[model samples]
Target: MNPSDAYLAHMDAIVREKVRSIESARAPEQEHYLGQAELWQRVADHVERYRDELSFIVRDLHANPELAFEETRSAEVLATTLERQGFVVKRGAHSLPTALRAEWQSVDFDPRRHRTIAVLAEYDALPGIGHACGHNIIAAAGVGGFLGAAGIGSGKIVFLGTPAEEGHTGKEYMIRAGMLDDIDAAVMVHPFNYDLSAHTWIGRRTLKVVFKGIAAHASMQPYMGRNALDAANLVYQGIGLLRQQMPPSDRIHAVIDEGGHRASIIPERAEMSIYVRSLYVDTLMDLSTRIDDILTGAALMAGVEVERSWDTHPMSLPVRNNTTLADRWAQTQAARGREVLPFGVLPDSQAASTDFGNVSQLVPGIHPTIKVAPPGVALHTKEFADYAATDAAVTAAIDAAVGLGQVIVDTLCDDHLMNKARSEFENAGGPIRATDLR
Candidate 1:
């Protein structure tokens, strides 16, 4: 058989096998659905049927961008779409008004069983370029994956509408509200620098540091003024000095959000956007304390008062890919002659953060990334935004949706696999309260 023919044949066998397994299961197995093969068929069907709609969703979101925490329309659109798929939708799950959650049953196990799996989607766009990061594509892919699962899911599946992933970390709010209470595992896909999903994320924190001081006429009384800009400047300098002593894997990036109002006056207030990253959340906290010291010390030196606010999401532990789940889908993909590739680099590692990390901490989750654009096509750029609408991205979306659907199905139906996944999840310090937020 030709490659395409072989692939189709492989898919046919997988679906048939999965259906047979589901049909053959005993009474105790009623809690699970049939495995990956059948789910793949249904998911691929959903992706194809909704291709134009998903593409339209992605493009429109890309075309009209909004800033973090300001994704009102997009959140509604996502909630509406999932509602149409028959999910019990709840809007504003996280403290953020724009966040939404879609809940439904798949496995008919215990009514309150923590068999729930969550699929996260981000709809907020960047300030200027809009879906430049291809978040719209990410949202659509998530919808496609869950809807496919909904068709054949034996356990619960949640479609979480996360409002702002670019910076505000809306998941942080939802985490505090206990919205993810019933969820046991969470999964999502992201656009990455490469095709492989590395399954690990570096811990990160965002800080908005502000300085306040007395203002005076610049030319007439510059020296008499307690300049807040001076404090901000010194803080940056302090950061530079600290960087020399930081670990090689550590990262610090900053942008001046506010420096001064007018040249005629010594500025009374200034602010900076800052982020610190390391491989572990503990390291991030430790580094944060050190950075805080620097900022305060700088403000004191400049004779200014300082105020700070943080936008931090609940940490997502490093992605713990359910290898069994990956293997099942990988085999299904390989049956079609497609090799499931590992990340060449840290495909899973992001200098950024996701609430999805919180989900990984609880369940056997995977946030695999696929290659739709060229290797150089960085996310959240006009170039990457352009590619998200291309034919290649669409193809990748369909394939990934099918692949993920298959994994979910296999997870539900295979008792050994499901139990293993749950065990690993618990061992990883699983099922913490949705209200557990730092």
Candidate 2:
């Protein structure tokens, strides 16, 4: 049964009261090398000048939605747009055909001393709900931010087009391909129900299990058959029961891909696909061990041979949002009249996973969210998809561009801020390799 209307209303009222009572704290005071007011004005001017073009990019990507690594035309459009702004654009970058790398640097740029900030973009859509996660807005905002930051011509800026975020870790792939080797920091904005500077995006790993057993006729000599389907069913039920013992941040779900061919005969083979998620890396690893035990126990109980496959693609680590950069992002958004909430203002129950988590482990980064829809409109839905193309989304995209651009400028120009960010990253167990987690 669905939640009662009265219950939902009461919860909404409570949420509203909480939101009203909480005031987002401002970032600590810090002076930048460049004049903040002048740089911010320049960023805002760029957004105003290219507002229409940014909107066009958003609508075009929304109209021509592509899935995962198949975003060929989408990559081309973004690369060409960046090229028009005098950036050196490379399509098919970082070992992915749909990925792009566009860069602009000052005359005196140096990889050894000068900092390089990457503005990440994800443009992949879901299977049936295209742009429902607001990747089109992400692409536009990233392009706009890169362009605005490039106009300053004080430091290096890279606009990275990362694909396959819907169900694949394209950013992780790019990272493995040395995408962040020389990059100092990264920033990106996601379209969400609220402007949040640091939200929980947990780790996720996929598991595939196949069971093989002896088959026999259901009506005749059924006792001789070892049903793989039964094992699969047990695994599902075991996971359901395991949920009660799991941490609130931990999530596990599975689907049986092959249960049986017919109800009459005992199934000889069964297959299941599962997803395990958690907010912490250690917790995710621990949960993975427990899940493996469950799969093994199910196979043993049914006397079926089982084969397991982990991470059909790449696994996504929980995002470690860089507060140093996030605070600057929040301040930038504040200048644009958007109160970017610090972490914990909203409930973490709405948390999801992102490939950028892997990117954060490699370099200091911030993945803030720009509000494009109402509070109740969840992502990955038709309602959110509809909102992703609205005027509100366009405005939010512009604001995100301005905010990201300012953050990049601040990181590049302010040596103190960058050092603090790097120190913070080191203090939080710096430079984790995603593969090592496995």
Candidate 3:
């Protein structure tokens, strides 16, 4: 059988079994959970039903891996599709070039939207490896989650198309704009090689520093040249020594983009890209600020003027995984027999930073990595890129959509569950966004 045919065959069994479970159970949480489970089975069936059409979406993303905040085509396509699906869509909600929100109203101007939920989709691709992180799948899964709850009886569903997760941390901008102003809770699942939870993400910042010196003939008047390259070298060495005193969790990495034009000349300018990270944003900034001291001191010693230009991505607070939400989410997912992980094995445990951390700081959120590839395979590789369209990944995507949708729906339906989540959120001692961290 062809790959598509084989995939559909396997998918059919998974969905059938899931539907059977749904038919057996009879509670709202169960019926709702099962009903939602059955919904995902339909999504899997829908994928098979629209394989060709959806493949176009994935292929388009693979073909053009745009940077964060610069995803013109991808955002437009996602927005247009959601609009057609009966959502009231807003483009550039946060004034971010690539940020948009698609809303579906059920109660009509809900004063108590009282409960609002967000299903997030990340669309930015790696600089060189297009969709290497499986964002195409992420985008589609976001759509699936939104579709799963397209017309729920109560509350509102917000499908957020966030651009620049790779670097822009677009979600932070959205949060700042009150894009999630009234949102009660948020949940997002990432494509991973395994199913796990209780992940941690470090805070991150971006730096661009430039050095300037008098240009002159290298051999003819070498004595007159200040040697910007040498000065930059000194700065790096200073940065390297500083690392020894920093906490082991801190990461300070920089690269020289230019040295001298040639041995025959003293380069007038040189630039470098710097990335600094730590488990906490406070530590990240403290570490990054130290690097500046080295740069300035080195330039003074070398008699070459130094110019520092830094563009830090949002200061991401450490990920605060909601223990209560996670425990309940796990139990609900486990009831389906898929074996949700035993917490603390997040995919990309080594990943330095993420905007999800920022969101968790603002409001309660889950950034769990769901199983999408073979256990041994690594992410950000060509092999994982191919798996983005795999049968296993697709099923997991549908399951995640249903699972997350149920979590939100469950939270919204229960006054107690909602309050419990909030109580736990405030207790975590995270960012409140107003006065806590300025």
Please name the candidate that would achieve the greatest lDDT relative to the true structure.
Answer: 2
TM-score for each candidate, following the candidate numbering: 0.77, 0.93, 0.79
N/CA/C clash count, model 3: 4
Task: State the weakest 10-residue window (summed lDDT) of model 3.
Answer: 1-10
Candidate 1 per-residue C-alpha lDDT over 299-410 given as tens digits, one digit per residue, 9 for 90 to 100 = 8899999997764444443244544454454444444344345432343234455656655655677776666777777776878777876776666666666666556656
> Cα deviation of 425 in candidate 2 (Å)?
1.1
Top-TM-score structure, candidate number: 2
Candidate 1 TM-score over all chains jointly: 0.77
lDDT of 3 at 19: 49
Q: lDDT per residue, candidate 2, 232-297, as tens digits?
A: 999999999988877776789899999889998999999999999987666677788889999999
Lowest lDDT 10-residue stretch of candidate 2: 1-10
For model 3, residues 1-438, the per-residue Cα lDDT tens digits are: 331232233345434534433343322344433355554454345434434434455567766778777788888877777676567778877768777788765656475545788878888887766787878767766776676666654677788888888877777777878767877777777877766544556777778878899888988998898888887888889888987876655678889989888889988788888887765545555666678888989888877888876655665555666655665566456654565565433432465567777777777888767777887677788888778767665666666666666666666565666677789788656455522443
Q: Which residues of candidate 1, in runs, are more than 4 Å off?
A: 1-56, 63-88, 91-97, 112-114, 213-227, 260-268, 312-339, 343-350, 426-438
Arrange candidates by lDDT, descending. 2, 3, 1
For model 2, the superposed segments whose C-alpha errors exceed 4 Å read 1-34
Q: What lDDT score belongs to each candidate, Candidate 1 first? A: 0.66, 0.87, 0.69
